[model samples]
Target: MKKPIKKQKAVLIILLSNIFIAFLGIGLIIPVMPSFMNIMHLSGSTMGYLVAVFAVAQLLMSPFAGRWVDRYGRKKIIIFGLFLFGVSELIFGVGTNVSVLYISRILGGISAAFIMPGVTAYIADITSVQERAKAMGYISAAISTGFIIGPGIGGFIAEYGVRLPFFFAAAIAFLACFSSIFILKEPLTKEQLAEISAKTKQTNFISDFKRSLNPHYFIAFIIVFVLAFGLSAYETVFSLFSDHKFGFTPKDLAAIITISSIFGVVVQVFMFGKMVDILGEKKMIQLCLIIGAILSVASTVVSNFLGVLLVTCLIFLAFDLLRPALTTFLSKAGGKEQGFVAGMNSAYTSLGNIVGPAMGGILFDVNIHYPYLFAAVILLIGLGITVMWKEKQLAESFAE
Candidate 1:
């Protein structure tokens, strides 16, 4: 028997709401960073350190966050994470110095560690194997929409004050937390929930990680790491790069990110599902690698911000498509290990986030263009990996 449509719709809505709010909070700060740099008297290296610390916290917490999701319940974790996210933003909003800001970022990372893994595993739990990719794509689309709208809203509101976005983000997060508590419902049965929860408490993080490293997932893990590494590396220096290279203002940065993210949303919502159906995960991964490399290089050669925005749109579209496709492949291979696999997926992403910003900061100090140039070269490794790995066949259940 199929799950009821009302319940499916509720799950989808709650998940989408949760994801959109989380990403919007993150994006809400992007357009105001230049102002932040000036007000806080921050250097490129300082910015890099600020960005990296969050990842470090996430990296450390991701493994356990997964375990908690499996052992506890997804709705509990999601609500708690959103509440933490709200508190972190409030910390940023009220902080007087960089020291206080560091505390806020650490909190943000911890929140992400909880929120993302819970969201992914929840989607896997509720969705059928055949529909997982499309479902993931919808989640990605929600994220993209947040990314698209966030900067524009941030830029507009930022005219009042650089820190205004943080307060606004905090309020939005609080709203999400409130909504989640009231609206979200677990999809699992008492027996199923008890079985999953019962088994997880006995396992340690290291042991769970080892179990998660099933050979089938090794390449999936690497793909996430590489993609996050390249993207975060590029992102760390983005504000600095545009400011130095194009003399871009906060508004200019906001416009570019908004346009590109809108394009990303369109591709994920409309194109990603179809592409996954046609090209298959392997071929699609190959294509993202090739395009990602080209765009990383192409971004630097652009004559103006408009040119940069155009290339960025294509790059985001590639990333948005590839993420869901890869997740679909991993979810299919996960057997009953959805929470563990999702946790490892986040762990790898956090690793990339940790390394990418540090590398970007160091390279930016040496030369503003070096980060993007080097990222292009690094992404070629991804292209190579996709060729070397042959994924396991999709489950027979997915044949529908």
Candidate 2:
């Protein structure tokens, strides 16, 4: 007889695969989005709005999605999320109107609200404290791998037509849905269910919401927000920088991003866990932020394509280190209320996404280099906040 699958193994496979497919969809669009907007006759401001709208939708839905995941189960929510994502991708691929594109992004955001928090809580449910960092690293690796391949393929297809990439994205989302439905077994144990129920009985929705709003969590969220904002700005303006300043084609930008993703995947998969253990999450975060800030600053000064590529790689390497450390820390900090904490973390990221591109668009309009400089300053601010913050006090309070 075939042996039953181990719960940890099952959860890891499901989470990683789901994240891979979800990010693959996103990757497919990244290289094509700006040109697609230009084709649709969208103004710069309108394009910013279009990009920000997804984050807005995610922000609005995250709190509820978190609570629902806690109330229900992870597998059901994830499957539903995958379904929604598939539908949204199909809409984006087929729609001709800009308004339809906006609506599609909104729907995609809602799917993200479900997928991200659910996957995080699911990982928390299955992994032990000792194993959490490494497991989270694997998830990050999956995402980075998706980023590596998605844009390259999208850029190739986009050479023919912009809409083709969306159709390709839709196919990927559909594959994720099918995988979740068939391959992902439920991972929750009876003990976990009882624990969740007991916690739910003690806390109301307001209290749950308030838990993540505490000083320590809030500060961590802010750090994530600032970092994400900077990264988003870089993402929004990098293509323009490539085209205008370096005379690089879309394919060239795609190749650069692919290289960054390769570096990111390597760090997250092989180095992040050891770094967290050696330096600790807080110190690791500080180090990453410092390096990222310097890299962002350098990107502004570097005009040559090779120099820009090197700086970009450095920035993404720092980002790769930061992501798993912060996520593992946040998930642990949430303790028994992993769903709520994951939701709040996701909300902070969405807020960053909303703010970053919008700010980048405005800066791009003024001067191409301004966005990277602005991002460097924000990362410096985040570094200051991290240094002064007292983590132990916050952990004690949350423990209560």
Candidate 3:
């Protein structure tokens, strides 16, 4: 049964709030990282390893998290994840040694694995197919907004104490977690659960991955991986690129990112769904790939700050649009298997996150421009994949 409009709206607001807080927590630590490293006397390699560890943990946990979301229930997984996220932040804030920080990051990654798929599946449960694109846009917007604001807030609060931001993030997460337990009702009822249960027998990650290779889903899944890989590759070294090429400071990089992110949020809120409606999912995906590919190369040639900022905004806008569009398309195709498909999506994304930065770091060492060039090549490949995608196959897969 469909939820009434007002209740649905309220539920979506709460869900987006949790998502915002989660990403906020992730971003809050970014500004404090240098400080933390100084305190621990950690090397740059250790910092890189810290990032890899989180992605690795998230990647390994995502498939199981997705399955649990389907089997146990979305609310259960979300609440549990939030609690884990809170505890992880608290540990990180207080810990003095490297090993404790690693443990905290691993737990943080596991929490993310649980939270992301659960939220996507929950949104699928609440919104109709026609309503999903806009809902997904809102989800993406909340995430972008949280991440954009988090660093600014973190930088400001760091004057009080370097560890304070993590504690603050933990407090907010716990508040959200408790609020959810009391207020967020399970969207799936008995009939929905039975239907989902019938379709989804317990399966391992490998089996689920193989199953996702069906004609309809394979292209979308590939798109997800390619998009994430390309974006992460582009972004991982962006600060270094700016500083190397243009002598940009931390404030300059932050300003560029902030402007781009704010523009992205405005577009997602005001124009994203309408544009998706006008362009259709396949065309929208293709267009975004084209934009990303072109601007990535353009980034290498821009000499002036304004030119760089403009190109960066366009690149990020393409990426921001692509994410929710893919999610909406997948949600429409997923039908009763929303959790399964969402899990697979998260897994592929984690794979991209892991590999993209590793490769980007290596390429950055060899040539400053190589990462952007590589990203362009990868996105062009994604564009080629989209060109071969067929709408009929998507409809037929859902019919099955």
Which of the numbered candidates is closest to the native, going by highest lDDT? 3
**Candidate 2 lDDT by residue in tens digits, 130-201:** 677888898889888887888778889999998898888887777877877877666666677567766664
**Where does candidate 2 have its weakest 10-residue lDDT segment?**
1-10
Which of the predicted structures, 1 or 3, would earn the higher lDDT when compared with the native? 3
Cα error, residue 112 of model 3, in Å, equals 0.5
TM-score result, candidate 2: 0.89
Shift of residue 387 alpha carbon in model 1, Å: 2.2
- RMSD to true structure for each model, in Å: 2.9, 3.5, 1.3
Better of 2 and 3 by lDDT: 3
What TM-score would every model get versus the actual structure? 0.89, 0.89, 0.97
Record all residue pairs in model 2 with backbone atoms less than 3 Å apart, i.e. clashing: none
lDDT of 1 by residue, 347-372 (tens): 89999888887888899999988999
Give the whole-model CA lDDT for all candidates, comma-separated.
0.82, 0.81, 0.90
